[model samples]
Target: MITRSERTLNYAVLVLFSVIALFPVLLILSTALSPDEIGAGGSALSLEFGNFAEAWEQGNFGSYMRTSVIVAVSVVTLATLFSVMAGYAFGTMQFRGSEVIFYLILLGIMVPAEALVVALYFDLRSVGLTNTLVAIVMPQVAQSVAFGTFWMRAYFRSSSREVVEAARLDGAGHWRTLWRVLVPMGRPAITTMIVLMFMWTWNEFLIPLVMATDESLRTAPLGLAFFQGQYTAGTSLLAAGAVLVALPVVVVYLFLQRHFIRGMVEGVAK
Candidate 1:
């Protein structure tokens, strides 16, 4: 229904915004590759790729990355599983107090984490979980599950009634109907949730900061903070470290971009 000029204008606006958003990323990448060593400089784009290596070694990013991967993977897996089951129940089944409980769960998303993190630290400490990876991961899982439940519930609620009725008529029980049918059909929504959870878990900072006192339990962002302090004068190294910290999130989004975008657009349309 749109005219050609309108479409062209829309594309131009999108391109302009894309470039504006990407400028900072490009600037960081350029600085990360810029020559840091003395007497080895040519242009700003000298392509001193060793800066990443030097930063990695100096920053002890390997350990930080491992911890982040562990926390991220654990939080995402547990949160996604729980969210799917909870969303399925809330979306499809009827029960007493269901609305009340669902709204209570929604409070987890509504409440600011900063408000609860201090108390949460003490609660975990009472259980002897402080300074452990469990402490770092559990809170994030709880947080992600809240939003994931909301996300998946919306998807399932609006899913095809005919498809669900057909599955029931085929003698499929709830479990079979969910895993064998609806879950498979909800791949885009699920993938979107997974990507989001992974990014959030990977980048979480405050929870890890409050929970972990041990150096080995530090997540990438926490490590990056320390790395920044240590390398205050080393701009190239700091830029490279930033890139390293962000690379996993970028890779994940790139890998799941199609499903993520489709899910977002569909959710909006519905």
Candidate 2:
């Protein structure tokens, strides 16, 4: 049904946007591989693979990467579990004040994290959690859970009621139905949520900057900032560090892109 002109126009737009998005990434890769420091003209193309090794050692990225992985994994795991449960209840079960409670939780998605971060910092400090991984992980977990619950609730609400009835008829209780029936069928949505949460938690900067004063506890992005500040003259190293920090996210997305896209499309349609 589509005209040739329309198809061409769509391809043109996609190519344009793709270039816009990829230009910076290509520049970074170029800079990272250049032997000389990047300048206004950007780094010259070369095959300096040693830049990554140098950046890794100089930036102390190993510890930062380890910390980031731990925090991201912990936050995503806890947030997904909690969000699935809360979303199921809100989507399927009726109880007193349930709407009110769900609305209150939804307030979290409405509010910006920047607005609450200052107060959250003070609250964590009061509890002696500042300068700790727990401080960063906890806030991000809460934030991720807010969005995850909202996302999963929509999925659950749109799920087939006949399936739930069948599960009940098979003597499956609510817990068993959720874990055995719903969860298995919800792989696309669940994987999408996990990927989203992982990216957010991995890329988080402000909370870690505010909460983590100890060098050992800094996340990869925070460490990259410090590395940038210290190695302003080492352009290749800086670009390499940036790539290293971003690699995990890129790798994860590539692996789960199919499920991620499917989940997003289905969620939107529902």
**Largest TM-score belongs to which candidate?**
2
Runs off by more than 4 Å, candidate 2: 1-13, 36-47, 258-270
CA lDDT of every candidate: 0.84, 0.85
Candidate 2 — what's its lDDT? 0.85
TM-score of each: 0.85, 0.87
- Residue 222 of model 2, lDDT score: 98
Please state every model's RMSD to the true fold in angstroms: 3.9, 4.1
Per-residue lDDT tens digits for candidate 1, residues 128-172, read 989998888888888888888888889889889899999999999
TM-score between candidate 2 and the true structure: 0.87
